[model samples]
Target: MKANRFVTVLIVLVFLVGGLFAQGQVERKAVEVKVLAGVTGGKDDTENALFEKEMEKATGLNITWEKPPSGYDQVLMQKLGAGEVYDLLYLNQFQMYALANQGALTDLTSRIAASSVYSENVDPDELAKIQMNGKYYAGFNKLEVFPLVNVNKAITDKVGINLNTLNTLEDYYQMLKKVKNYMENTVGRKPYYPFFTYMPDIWDLQPWFSSAGVRRGVFKDASGKKYAPFVQAQAKPVWEWLAKLYREGLMDPASFTGKTGDMRNKMWQSQEIVMDVDWAAWTGLYNNNAMTAGTYPHTVNVVGLPGTKSPSGTFMLEQGGASLWAIPANAKHPDEAFKIIEYMATKEGGLLLSAGIEGYDYVIQDGKLAFTEVGLAHAKDHGAPFPISTQFDLGVLGTMNPGVLESVAIGKRADVEVAPMGYADGELDARKYYDIMSKWMTDCIMGKMSADAAMRGAENELRINSLID
Candidate 1:
């Protein structure tokens, strides 16, 4: 009888333990989501792997990433055209707008609005943005714009140049010329540094144009008539300014196309570049690197761009959010997709996305956050601390740009706001128009053709494209 009782007790314990195990397993839903343009990490990397392991446990998500190096553009486009199945689609601005217009994207309006988890995780004002044609079709990350002129004070002080007083295109050009002449006369003919924009992409030139009261290739006059940014009278000063930089050898040739960030960074790190157009955060990062290298790097002063009227107002990229994640109209697991997106959009999720696991990737010491040495080094190569929402930055980076907020040196120049781009003057295609103006701008800056010739060519293209009508 005693032996029978012992056996009965053992059997009961086995059932209890198994029941608990089953319950725990039930708590975590096994979600396998194929996500495009998700975070790409090295498969063999210990840190990324660890983070992913923890993230899976926390979010109950196993994400399969799409291809990289070129991203999911081509494959996605092909699949989208073929009407293939996908749960969520990550799109660029053009893609989001175009696809949504074609009814390929599902309207996320009701689901996102009703989601308490989503609402609490992001900013209060963010919901207003993500809307196109008054309907929310996607989710986006928030971004802030603080355009600054990162300059080396050592060079400027030596040249007896004061950047504070400098405004307008002519002022900047002359100052760069002075810096160039002084550098060559004192250091050597090596052209160690001159005036250089950081990335030099067409989009990067937005700062100068914004400062000049022309936002996104259009300027509205007192009558509110919109005119193209490349018009001769309006573009002359902008072109003339850059032309001098290129023609006089003051601006790096790479500035026209903006393909020389590596060379620019090397020069900046060595305290050789005089002026650099960079954001406060990255500027501070480079400055810190220079300091650590014992380069005696000059103090990088932040200034407003030339001809900026409202220097206080910087161009905010995607005032709505960073990248927009949209669900396809024909997605199978729409609810599951939203679950992942909502989780990723939360503060907890954002923290995980940006800083990674605390002990491995970063550490909090005395109420301050710092990246581990490995994390810091890896971050430089991997990319910025990417939170799904731009509002949550890598804590370490937030510390770097304290001075940026304090410096309100941008003059109250005219504020140029770019409304959403549409078919300009009923022109079905504005791409050729952009191409023409871009070619002109390039030609003018490279001195391959004068601004007049460039403008004439642009106008001819505009006419041929039927944009003038």
Candidate 2:
């Protein structure tokens, strides 16, 4: 009787174990998703991986990532035009407007409202950026505009100039002259250029112009007409000032066509440049390599750009949030995509995507977040996996770090202030501005044409494109 009773218990235990295994497998749903994203360095990679991992776990769905090799916007356009459907799409300001105008993207306002996770995580201001015609179409992970000027402390010290004392554009010019003189006399090398302003890209040029009390390119007038600030009378002084920098050899001539990678390498490896304006993401790359090679000088620091007041008696345009994430009209699993977006926006998700898995990747010590040396080394060398939302999407969930805010305060010139350029509307015609402005600005910066001529040409082009009445 005892032997028979023991046999019955063993059989029940075996069945129970099998049932649990089957249940686990059943809960996991197998699905495929294609995502379009712009390629950046570490943060983007880490964020993309984290989003995929978390969403897979929560929804029991397997996601396949299909990222394009070239320009994400162009690739997305081509794919959509070809009738290719993706599970999720990453949209920037231009692309979002273009796609929405073409009816190529889904209305996400309803989906966002329905998701408890999204409702809890998203901020109002952030939500405003993604809205078009009173409907929300995109979500963001962070909501701050971060532009940091990285300076080589060694170069400044070698010239005996105080970095802190340099505030105005004139002060900046004098310091650059000193550095250039030092390079010529002592090092027998080109003293690092004073400013490596990227003229080919309007996004880059906007901030510098913004510092000079001019909000040019994409802005509006009092009558609500779309106006290019660079062409206005107020912009004349600013352009003339930059033209002087070019003529005086304070700024690099090659920056007109230099790619971002070329500029990054020149600053990081060669240390040939004294200062370069870049986003905060570059900081991670700098910290990772600076200590290992001991190439970066200890005195180097990051700060904001100088700002000036406009003649109109207002400050330069105040910048706002960067990029955001949008789901494509053809996304296969919209529901699952929203879940992933929500997770990354939440505190729990932000930590995971930005920092990584807690015990394995980082540890908290003394109420301060500290990475183990090994963890830091790992992040520096191998790079961490982050969710896609955190990288492309801004203002969805995570709060800006104090450092970013401080940089903004520093960059704001006393006379220059930030102003809103108006939120993006779902209009395909808006994208025409990019093609027109980029061409005209490039011509103006290269000295191929006069600023006045370029402005007139741009106006004519806008008229031709129907952007102006």
Candidate 3:
């Protein structure tokens, strides 16, 4: 009878442990993570649904992707201002820093230090780039691409210009003149302007300024004194060059007032502008769009030039700031949300982000990724064109857009200096600096004020705003 009682008690203990295991599985699966995305998603509901499903399956957490149709920046600000809770939020580097300053973001320093996946997949330098006061608050979304000079080779070719031979600001100016003359006289497009720049924030000027070794934004010397390159004497020639373009009608007057969409249209669709400083991705995108319009290579072959040499005798390209993912301080599932962030820093996660959902986006034919018609149409990048994972194989994503490989290779050149926009060790408010510089610089470029006067005004305003010491 005692032996029988022992067997019954043993069965009861087994049942209790099994029940607890089942409950744990259910709880793990029940964890919900809501993400508010700003940079990516919005392809369509179908694609968004597929992406969420795949992410959920991979991370083993229920993920809700909240990607606004438009005005994402405004939406982001509104939601955060109103104290709306979200597990994860997508932000640019500036937003990350701004929020970090407000203590709105969770400090991920300890968590990231403890993560093996991050150590294996993410570059330490990249992590260093996003740290605030030596503490991590976010993880990188993608490797930033730089803006450079993109010229329509077809237009340049018509003018008998060899893009390879162009190496100075004067060379670019001459090339633009030739294109402008050809478009007006030969192509019969009256008053043809060959260049465009968004002057509101003084966007797309880094390539031109790099010619004079003027780096954009705030920086410090070895003695730790803050200074802005644009307000220095070295920047005068660069300003004068732009004024020359504006005065000579080589630059579009609408550049000061037009949106980036207008610039893109002039670059690819209208083919009115033969040259402009734009993102490296735009080099490929230009070719791809032209190809879609059936005017590629021969008529609209857009190619990237590493711009004129800096004083250091190297091509200087400024990287766009980082796109990142961060968890809010009020997140309910901080630990679970971090699991997603950690997973994203893995090879498997990189594959999903780059190649899209397996079987849906691609199929294994002969042990290789064979993209479907849908995948072929979309070009396979959900958010990260270059995944943050060091272990990721880019070849798995298949062919890139035309002109992309050539443009991307420019960053790897030994003669090139690919630098980020200077931030004075994260003490600078980029938005304020941009506004102050834009106000004064527009006057200079538009001939309303002398370059020296504009620089003086910008410098004073910058000092008042504490953007520079």
Candidate 4:
């Protein structure tokens, strides 16, 4: 009887130990995740590689990155429609809205609220961007600053234009005329045209429209009960300005139909365009590298265009929010993925990804962040690699660069002042309005329609869309 009892106890002990071992094995396995990310040239070659390496090192999670062919929205819609499981998904404003409206994305309001990282990192105003009916759906990566007008110093000097005093609309036109004449008479070539305006994209129109105090298509009246359409009123003056420029040959003809990539190539490679509006980050990267390589004629300087109001006023509609890192609703290992996102937002993780390992990638000197030679080369070549979207949870306020902030100087001018309109939600579908206005605006600019007729047509279309209702 004693021997049998002892054998029974031994058997039970073995079973318990085996069960524990099995559980441990399961826990040790890395969480498998598939992520869809939009591919930019720099991202494919550099940032993605570094992100993969760092994420693996920080968390044992293995991630598979996928790029959708063609439109990201179409790919997402198809995948969700087919019930395909994605561990994580990167979404732009349009994609976020479409998915949210379809009930495809999980509501992350509670999760974000519960997270110490999120609560600490996000600001009240920045948090507003992700909210729909007070529920948070998505996060932003980095706040997109207002577009900067980049000028070639050589071209400006050649035309005898004073950079500082060119602060009015009339002054700008005069400068462009001077450059056009100088190129025609002296160089026997266009030294540089006045502006390379990309008309096909709505973002290209933002600066001009905003400068005229036109806040999108909708603005609330004083009573708050009525919302007035700004486009009809504002487009008149703005389109007139554009028409004047077009007639004088100050604006590039290619701008009306060329793709953004084509426009960029013309500006950078041909060096025939003097002024173009682009994101400060992109301009910085291009100018920095081009100058370093000795391929560019002069260092590109960022200057603010003349605004109707204060320099910052022209930028009131500018979107400022955090980009988010989120696990998909169907994620197999949600907890593990969240932990990885958490780590990435930490100071150590940010430094590792942004600056890289200190001794090897960068070093602090005289209390300033200084990049090593390798780091400098990497920055010049790779640009910002880590998904800054994850860093949104860090709650750290970032200062704009001097050049970028300088572009806002016009916003501060005494003659210029920003009149606040309501929030310009990036994700909302203003497609119908955009389509109608774009068609009419193009027609008006091309002299196919009168400004008054275009304005009337736009009002009728807005009413039909129930925007006024």
RMSD score of candidate 1 (Å)? 8.3
Error of 3 at 153 (Å): 0.5
lDDT of 1 by residue, 344-385 (tens): 676666666555667776788877667787656555222124
In candidate 3, stretches whose alpha carbon ends up further than 4 angstroms from where it belongs are: 1-30, 220-225, 425-427
Model 2 worst lDDT run, 10 consecutive residues: 380-389
lDDT scores in order: 0.58, 0.58, 0.86, 0.57
TM-score per prediction, in order, is: 0.71, 0.70, 0.86, 0.71
Error of 1 at 439 (Å): 2.2
**Model 2 lDDT per residue over 1-469, tens place:** 9999999999999999999988776555335655555532123456446545655665566765555656777787788889887766666666677677777777888877887666666655556656777787776644444445556566677788776665555666687788877876788875446667666645455545554465534444466566555566656555666666777777777777788777666666666667776654454454335545675445333334433333454434434434556787777778777665676566565555455544545666675456665445445221112232323332321233323334544433455444434332433254567678668866766667777777788878877775653
lDDT of 1 at 364: 80
lDDT for each residue of candidate 3 in 167-253, tens digit (9 for 90 to 100): 888998898898888899998999999999989888788888888898899988988889999999999999998989999999999
> How far off is residue 343 in model 3, in Å?
2.3
Model 2 residue 204 CA deviation (Å) reads 2.0
Say which candidate scores most in lDDT: 3
Better of 1 and 3 by TM-score: 3
Regarding lDDT, does 1 or 3 come out ahead? 3
Collision count of model 3: 0
Clashing pairs in 3: none
* TM-score leaderboard ranking: 3, 1, 4, 2
lDDT of 4: 0.57
Worst 10 residues of 3 by lDDT: 37-46
Q: Please list the residue runs of candidate 4 whose C-alpha ends up more than 4 Å from where it truly belongs after superposition.
A: 1-34, 39-50, 59-72, 119-123, 143-146, 190-192, 217-230, 292-324, 330-335, 343-433, 462-469
